[model samples]
Target: MGMTIALDAMGGDRAPGIVVDGAALALRERPDLRFLLIGDRARIEPLLVRHRRLSAAVELVHTSEAVAADAKPSLALRQGRQSSMRLAIDAVKDGRAAAAVSAGNTGALMAMSKFVLKTLPGIDRPAIAAVVPARRRPVVMLDLGANVDCTAQHLFEFAVMGEAYARAALGVDRPSVGLLNVGTEDIKGHEAVRDAAALIRDSGLGIDYRGFVEGTDIPEGTVDVVVTDGFTGNVALKVAEGAVRLMASSLGDAFRASLRAKLGYLFVSPALRALRQRFDPRLYNGAMFVGLAGIVVKSHGGTDAIGFSHAIGSAVRLVEEGTNDRITAEMRKIASPGPQLVAASS
Candidate 1:
């Protein structure tokens, strides 16, 4: 028997259609996978007819309601009980699926997953972790818009979860972890970061803890995992993404500036194409809500079928790799009596 994943089929910018199409794409790659697609029967059924294999592998659960793109997290939580997004998460909570994937409202998805799945034993809050392109390899950064404000202990927990994530999802063995800050110096950041660093260092968690890393270090691949509060992580993510867009745009304009430049593009086109592929946002669509008891992947809302398929792929890997198990085991180590985590002074 294969692992089943619950999909919020009515949840994206282009609902039902892209959801079904993405599932079809994912099914081709992982034949053993099964799906519990939750959405409107009328819209989803027509798309399924085109992919007989997927239709066979899927069990559709009908729901006409869906959380709006702009819906507040609290409103969605209170009123979206019958929404496809909520129902799909419900499947995970009810043991009907091994994981849940959504291209829905980010806040709503995070809110619902936390409410339904709860956090792992040692975790106070679940953090949203995603892979970002780096110089050497992709880095896993967490607390991505999940909790804007966090305590030192919370950041410490994020490091533990992030290290486990790198090992499970990125195939990194003994991944190096870092606390994001203004400077590499221990005294530079606010008390929370300094304390989190101290906790990770003294806790004897066996994590390869790199003291501090700046925002520039993220793209430079200074560490395998970057841990921060959601507010900073979210801001850094947007800044990096915006920078990539700006660079791409500038390159395009330069290439079209003159006939000479256009001719020059022919020679660099292959290399540029390779670079584009390496940094394509679609390739890194899935953001895992780490620390949750059950797997939940949030796909980019505007992503196409290919991107959504990658998000599904992320869910498959997380389940197959037993990411939560790794987290639990690591957390247990900290809970044991060897070296207690030091409390940071407020």
Candidate 2:
């Protein structure tokens, strides 16, 4: 049977409509793919009728409740059993779908997904990993707001998952992994980061362990996989996003500064549009929750149909490539006796 993706049809800020439309967009790209749209039948059915092509490939599961945007994770965990988010996750856990996609409350989605699918064996906690467009090639960074506090061990696991993700998702043969820190030298970061770096360096886990990378190294494509705790990774991701937006905003202002500038805008518009596409967040909307037994992709809640389609595309990629299995294979390479941290010479 063709792969099916379970979707929370009423999860996002502009849901049901946007979700349906996004599914239609995805179907245009992958006609063999199928969808199980779980949400209000009344809201979803009407939209499905508008896209005859998508309607044939989709199956709607009526769900009356939805996890509220402001709902606390704990509240959703207890009260959202019948919600669209939970049901979508259930579809994946039940073997009815290959993966699940949601643009819902982040905390609630994570809570419910963990409760339903459970973490893969050997994983302490799931981490959010995403593809980043680096100068040389796409880079994979992990722990983007999944676990606010992570141990040195967690960072090591992130590296393992990230290396596999780079191979499966980005087609990197042997991805170079780096620990994000204040400086590249040994003894530059806190105990957790320093320890993680040392372990990776000496573990001989078949990973191309690059010593350490600073914040500036991310966009520079200094490493193929950047591993960090959730707190730092989230902050760095946000900063990079903000910087891109600022560049676009400044360009718009410069183009509208004067009549002469307007003339120049006409000549520069095409180049700027190309650059915008390269940095478009929608192209990289899907955030994969790694280290889970089942696949779950989180889309930005405020994203449009185009962005949501990309999230679904990401889910498709993970399912097709057996990303979880790849991660497991990589984890198996860690030596039975954990390697001791070897301090590098100053």
Name the candidate that leads on lDDT.
1
Q: Write the per-residue lDDT of candidate 2 for residues 1-346, one digit (tens) a residue.
A: 5799999999899998788999999999999999999999988887887899899998889989999999999999999999999999999999999999999999999999999999877777899999988898878999899888888899999998888777766877888999999998897989999999877876677789978999988999999999999999999999998988898789789889999999998998899889879978889888898999999999999999999999999999888888899777666656334434333322
Off by over 4 Å in 2: 335-346
Candidate 2 clash pair list = none
lDDT of 2: 0.90
The backbone clash count of each candidate, in order, is 0, 0
Give the TM-score comparing model 1 with the true structure, all chains together: 0.96
Instruction: Provide TM-scores for the models.
Output: 0.96, 0.95
Question: lDDT scores for all predictions?
Answer: 0.93, 0.90
Q: Write the per-residue lDDT of candidate 1 for residues 85-126, one digit (tens) a residue.
A: 999999999999999999999999989888888999989999
| Model 1 residue-pair collision total | 0
